[model samples]
Target: MFDCIIVGAGPAGSTAAYHLSNQGRSVLLLEKKSFPRYKPCGGGVSPAIQQWFDFDLTPVVDNKVNRVRFTWKKGDPVETELDTTEPFWMVQRDVFDNFLVEKAVEAGSELQDNSEVTAVQISNDIASVTTSKGKFDARYLIAADGASGAMANWLGFKEAKQFLGAVLEVETAVAPAERNTAKFEFGSLKNGLLWCFPKSNGYSLSAGIIRGGKGKVKDLEKQLTNYASELGINLSQSQFYNYPMNLWSSERQLHQNNALLVGETAGIADPLIAEGIRPAILSGVKAAEAIVKALAGDRNALAGYTDTINSEIGSDLVLAQRLSGLFFQFPGIAYRVGVKRPYAGKMMSRILCGELRYADITDMAMQRLKSSLIPGRG
Candidate 1:
């Protein structure tokens, strides 16, 4: 029997396995897909994740984006140059995830690729996981199988509110001048934002509604294609992929009995930008820490997981949810006041780079707006 059986080999699962194994816990990491499999993502990661890993990630980093261009309805763009000290890094998820799984293996975690988890059950103090390869029993189970994973449903965790985001990753030569820049387009859709991110060879262009709805998938595809055409690039032959972006909610349970949910399964992604890497990794580490404490005679360790997440990650997500509603509901005001304002754009870039939090910047933007509205108050 393993001390911990983790489902999924993505960033969250792999990070949990690595940390657990490093502490001498017997960890079994399972993945539904083989290594280096393509994952649909904008692939933008802030440098803040550097604090989680000890090794250099230069191998997987495809580009360092020092500039960001924000546009509203394909109108005049507001561009901002990021701080020289810290810039956003982009990577192909396939390469980056494989690298992380390799690190988990190096840390003594047993990885089983192509092993799809079929069922998960927790009885008393033990968890039983049934996978395609075989059955495994462990003291604890960590679910990092992403938004569509069934482990959460099988284990009876409260359903999280999910948002759908789509991406079209294509390989085409990009000019040197445009290679290191990232672009975000607002007001293009009624309920979503569009993005074009630079990759090593080409770009990943995507569009999706922040709050998901049916019948918009095809519209997102058309929007992406039209946007690409405006930039003089054709995505007719490019590979297209779509995935759900799960946003965190206080009502969702993080741990139930001996089973714990992490990553997108737990809905920890940023609601505003739909970014998942930072929250996913942070949740993984925190989950491991909780399991470690639970093993060390603290029976209530798992119970505190939700509280910890609420304090650290949830507060920011709550603010992001509010900001998302405000921005998307009033895109024109957001564009004119927030995006067009130099200070606001700089703060936004800082938030994107993980230099600042959404709560901080939201307050700053509100203060700026107040100052602009009432001149004598300043």
Candidate 2:
């Protein structure tokens, strides 16, 4: 029997396996798809993620963004250059994910690609996972199979109410002026935003919209197409991809009966921006730490996971949820009066870099809005 069985070899599962295997514990990482498989993502990673790894990620990083451009409706875009020592990094998900899984393998974890998990059962403190390849028994099971996976249902966990966000992305050549700059446009969709991120070979243009919004998916696509055409970019020749993200909720149950959930399975994406990579990696690392402590005879080790996430991750998401509600409620005012103000964009850039928490900046953002909306107000 393995010490831990990790489902899905994405960032979360691979990170957990890497840590567990490095501790000399037997780890089995199962993936439904082959290595280098495509995953729908913007692929923007905050520089703070460097704290989690000891190795350099330069080989996988497509670009280090130093500038951000924000737009509201048809108004002139406001551009801001980040003044930090290190900038945010962008990568392609397929390459980045494969690299992580390879690290897990190098750390002695057994990786089984094309091994889709069909079912899981826990009894007598042992977990039995049935996959396409075969059945495996382990002391603990980590569910990192993402939002679309069925691990939560199989484990009898109640489905948490999640804010569903959708994305449509394409890659195409960009102009010299667009290189190395990330762009965000709001007010095009109700309660949503569109983005353009620079990739290694081209630019990735995407549109994100919250579910049950003013427009449907088709409307969002039309907006993106029109926006691209306005910029003289042709998306008709590019391939289109779509995916959904499940935002985090505090009420979600993370662990039960030696089975723990991590990554999208636990709804760890940011409520405001739908950012998932950093939280997924962090949750994976925290889950591994708990598993290690539990294996050392601390039955209550897993219990601390709730508190840890609350303090480190959940707190920020909670603040994000509140800010998202306020921002989306009046995106136009938020954009014109808040985001366009001096230092406001910088604060957001700092937030994206993981240098400032949303909880800490909400008040400052409100004050900026007030000063802009009401003349002679500080």
Candidate 3:
């Protein structure tokens, strides 16, 4: 029997399989889509993620971003700049994810693409996975199948909470090279953020707009047109990718029996931005490390998965959820406030990078609120 069966070959599953197999464990990776499949993402990677995985940008990066802009959804579009020593990079999901899986393969993980897993069961300390190809058994099973993870749902685990109803993403070319800044629009969409992340060849335009539990494609298109017009960017020939934004704060439980959940399966998205890739990759690696530790004599090693993930990601997500609610409450007002309030934007950035913790954020927010409340303190 294989040591582990990792379902879904996204960053999480592939990372897990990579680490486990590198340790000489027999790991099986299954994916429903063929390699180089498309993924709906904002595609921005913080500098911290590079250090987290010892990632080399030369392999999969599409562009390096040194600037960011945040505009109010319904308020005046004020911009902020951070000329940091480090830069955030963008990569196409297909290239980035395929590269990661290839790394896993190089490390010895067996990958089976275009293989959709239909069922899974645990018996006698082994998992029997039934996929389109056939049946296989493994000592452990990891569900990294993403937002609509069938395995987690089938197993009755708590799924990622859908905060914003729908997300509209489009890729197109923006002519002016000077406007190559990642911009976040805050005021127009209620409780959502619209963005334009520049790529090497084009830009990825996206928005998380709540549509009363459903999304309107036409309305989203109109909004995109308006945003583009404001920026003087043409998008008549843009390619679009639409998907749901499932944020994973307040995640209930992730582990059960011999099954462990990672990535979107564990609901690890940023509630504020609906970002999940970096966290998914980080959690996947941690889950694998946890499993490795467990198999190496610490019976409680597997039990540490939840603890480790929470310790690494939970706090920031909580704050992001809070910030999401605040911004969604009144996009215009919040965006206006965020422009002069560098801390607000910095908090968002730091949270994404895992440089700040929940308690730290809570204290800072409370202090800021207290200061604002004091007469003449501002």
Judging by lDDT against the true structure, name the best candidate: 1
Q: Evaluated with TM-score, which candidate comes out highest?
A: 1
Residue-level lDDT tens digits of model 1 in 168-208: 88788888888888999998877788999988778899776
Where model 2 places Cα greater than 4 Å from the true spot, the runs are 162-169, 211-215, 367-378
Give a tens-digit lDDT track for model 3, residues 95-141: 98999898888889888999999899988878899999999998788
Better of 2 and 3 by TM-score: 2
Candidate 3, residue 96: lDDT = 89
Tens digits of per-residue lDDT for model 2, 1-378 = 999999999998999999999899999999999898988777888888778877777788888898998888846689899866688889888999999999899999999998899889999999999999999999999999988899988998877554434444555666677777888888887778877788767666666654343346566667767766666676655655565567764645688999888998888888777789989999999999999999999888777775687778988888787777778777877887778877878888888888888888877666665565566664
Q: What is the model-wide C-alpha lDDT for candidate 1?
A: 0.84
Alpha carbon lDDT of residue 10, candidate 3? 86
Give me the displacement of residue 78 in model 3, in angstroms: 2.7
Worst 10 residues of 2 by lDDT: 160-169
lDDT of 3 at 250: 63
Backbone clashes (count) for model 3 = 6
lDDT, model 2: 0.81
